[model samples]
Target: MNRFAGRVVAITGTGDGQGRVAARRFAAEGALVVGADLDAAAAALTEKLVRDDGREMLSVAGVDLTDEADVVRFVGAAADRHGRIDLLYNNAAAARLGDVTHTSEADFDFTFRGVARIPWLLTKHAVPHLRAGTDPAIVNTASVSGIVGAGMVGNAPLLAAYGAAKAAVIRLSQICAVELAASGIRVNCISPGLIDTPAVAGILGTGVDDRLRGWHEEQTLVGRIGTPDDVVSAAMFLLSSDASYITGHNLVVDGGWVASGGAGRPHRDVVEALEASLAAGLRY
Candidate 1:
């Protein structure tokens, strides 16, 4: 699967997790990978891992994706090196979590700005280079939370801002697809559900959330938690020639969790407890 051979791929959030996985996979598949991240050390480590794998990868560290200047620098470096960018992966997001009533103005603004604004900035700057690319494509990472209200453990609606931001991401991808269509550039997104990443595990109070994994597996028809490989595979296909005709699409890579539609949502008691907590003016 050397579909990306000789192609220049610019990806965000390559410091770790899904971004790291995607960077490695792209490098392994013969792409000239250029990556950026907010964590300097972690991004360097990702670069080292790719180089250790005997693949080509160059990474920039401490990149603030929400900043248009930073996004332009990231895109500019790639174009300056390769003369064109063959793919753009808008895969970075760092934001806050809070329910509407308690969420501060600053946190809400930062959350929406981080999750939704960066992708647009990257796409805008990368567009000029992509216009000169070979069968270029872009993949944005949204979440299943964007498709529905992101009620969490105990039915806590603590991620309302993130959900709204991701919903904007989904819409951004669609609009970009239509706007970039004349340039032969395809744009799409993958909305994943309950992926068992390190971030998710930590949120569940451990290095690994076995109980949470089991609960989601039971709910998802696939009987397992989603993995970075699952996302990378779907993303690669969208960027590949196989999906040349596809654009303006949102691929729900949730292992059928969304289709099942809250089949295993928290019990009624939990929802009631949440309602009570809210009524009491409890802060998440």
Candidate 2:
């Protein structure tokens, strides 16, 4: 509690979901939060929510993470206001559900541009400022798909490009951690499973809450899926001094999905149906 007291945090993709929740959690723990996102309106909404809860926050212009100028400006503005940024939550990402062959070049570019490139850019710019701060840390949100194959969901191709990009993020964070250790900047990553977020709704083409509920109960092994708070908790731990010795670590916050190690293995009936479907060429 109050681990982040008097700290300053900058979080990208703070418009909704994990980013928004992270901002609120930091603020509640006495951190001054700067929320940034591509959607200006959504960022404003998040800002209001934090403010409504009597927390300190600042909303900045939405930055295209792929753009160097935008990232520089966002990082500069945050440092100018807060004096220093203690934590950087690189949580913005886009999802594309398709096989490697089926995924388009544009999809790959868009996903990496928003998720990987932006976070890398922000890290580059935020380094000096973070180095000047007290207990500086960076928390990147990767995914379980980055570490393991995503299972089939109604014959849909799992997130191919998205998973690859997130894997890169994990490696990037690890490299940063090793390189920046001398500078007193800790870099860590969190790999989440299925979290109930607006982006999930878009990917699944279903109502957010309904899809989340179903996935929580049936798909995840923990009898429920993750929430933004689950991720925020991991992030907070990395950013806090409690994890001072922890660096270059990838924390998986999935609901026992990755731990189970039985993701790609199908049940007997499911395997029979899949074989039958394949023999019939119905899958193709």
Candidate 3:
């Protein structure tokens, strides 16, 4: 509703998915948007989306958020272009799936850095400009994985490191909220449940698509999986004045999965046993 008119927003991971949606939505709200992503093509695509809407947006490709230098450059360019920074949306991250027992050192580190360190690095540099901007706020993307284990979300059992890294993000957002309060910058995070995003297209693809999709939909209390727009709406609220009193808070955009205590998920043993019973002679 144009709440962000004239506001400058710097978003990470704008190459696609939630980040791309964020860039376009923020720009649509009249916010001056700048974005970065490791995917040059995807980042350019986000820029084009905003442009196609007849809005201006600057996007930098191949930005390694784990690298302090790249983080600094991205933040600096946003400030230089907009003369201030009103929002920092730390929305980029990726992870490799492997059991904790099988997860290599490189994989763990890669996930940890991508999921957690990017926010820290971006905040480190953007805080200065944000200090001078109007209604400055930082919204980092966390996942329900941070609050729970991989088992709680889905059958993917290799997200130990990703969970650990996102846990750090949860704590980081809390820290920044307190640290940046004196400077008039609000810090918060959004923890999304399993959503329909490109990141998981492979996992939910192929022969297992229908099965896993059904499982996920059942696991959620709302009887459906989440969407990128589901998260974008929550994020928009947190960035808007409606949530001006909120800080150091994590908004979970799951469709009641967390609240349901993952009640919809039945243990494999139970399911198998029940099937055996049905096949044998146990019938209604």
Candidate 4:
């Protein structure tokens, strides 16, 4: 499609999952991609995929996004190489599975440093170069958890921190969208729901794939889970001219899970109980 032809894109957390998928999708569509990640090996893999697919790309040194100097250097090098930055995908994050009471200070700090603070820092450093490019846009990866409370009855602590951090990302993107609108830059966010990614695998423990399959059927109204490609597709649309009028929008791609009115079906016990209550006419 080449929607991104002649464009320069810098994506963080391209090691795997959503970031890697986004890098690949953009590169395939004719964008010059700079893949950055904490895992050098995974970044290289993405770079190779881009090259093998006959796409324009460069594999850069990993940046410790929490480190201010490191982020500056990474963005500076990308801009220096590309002469300008057209797109910035702030897609990196860290996760810890603990409840509020069980989560430690270190866990909270780590999540904020990697997910919250890094995105802000990246935007701050990349804005100058983005301002000089064609159709500049920033796509942040928030989550369904960020939009609403995660239904993690057992893993409350970990989900709490993760959800809170993602909510902050959503709000931050909105503020950036407003502040940067006059500069011809668009800021948007993608809030994914239970996509099949490495991070989700970690959360499911053993038999993760099977668990995910079951979860998809149960939670999503579409009767299936999502893949990284689903998210990448959303990102591509938001970054393209097709979404010129969209900003400060948190698009949820959860297979109708969020829109369902809880009317799919009721369990046998609930149906039987309801029928009995109706038959007895015990209601007030």
Whose TM-score is greatest here?
Answer: 3
Model 2 per-residue lDDT at 211:
63
Off by over 4 Å in 1: 151-154, 207-210, 264-284
Task: Superpose all Cα atoms of candidate 2 onto the true structure and report the RMSD in Å to 1 decimal.
Answer: 6.3
For residues 210-256, write the lDDT of model 4, one tens digit per residue. 56356445666776667899888998999999999999998987776
Tens-place lDDT per residue, model 3, 1-284, is: 79789888888999989988999999999988899999998888888888999999988889898999999889989988878898888899978778889999999998988898899999999999998799999999999889887544455686789889999999999999999999999999999998888887765553656777777778877888788999988988999999999999999988888887776656688889899999999775
Q: Global CA lDDT of candidate 3, please?
A: 0.87
Clashing pairs in 2: none
Count the clashes in each prediction.
Answer: 0, 0, 0, 5
The estimated TM-scores of all candidates read 0.89, 0.87, 0.90, 0.90
lDDT digits (tens) for residues 22-121 of candidate 1: 9999999999999999899999999999989998798978889989898889999999999999999888898788888999999999998889999999
Write out the backbone clash pairs for model 4.
98-157, 98-158, 99-157, 99-158, 100-157
Candidate 4: Cα lDDT at 11? 88
- As a TM-score, model 1 comes out at 0.89
TM-score of model 2 vs. true structure:
0.87
* Candidates in order: C-alpha RMSD to true structure: 7.7, 6.3, 4.8, 2.8
Give the lowest summed-lDDT range of ten residues in model 4.
258-267
Error of 3 at 179 (Å): 0.9
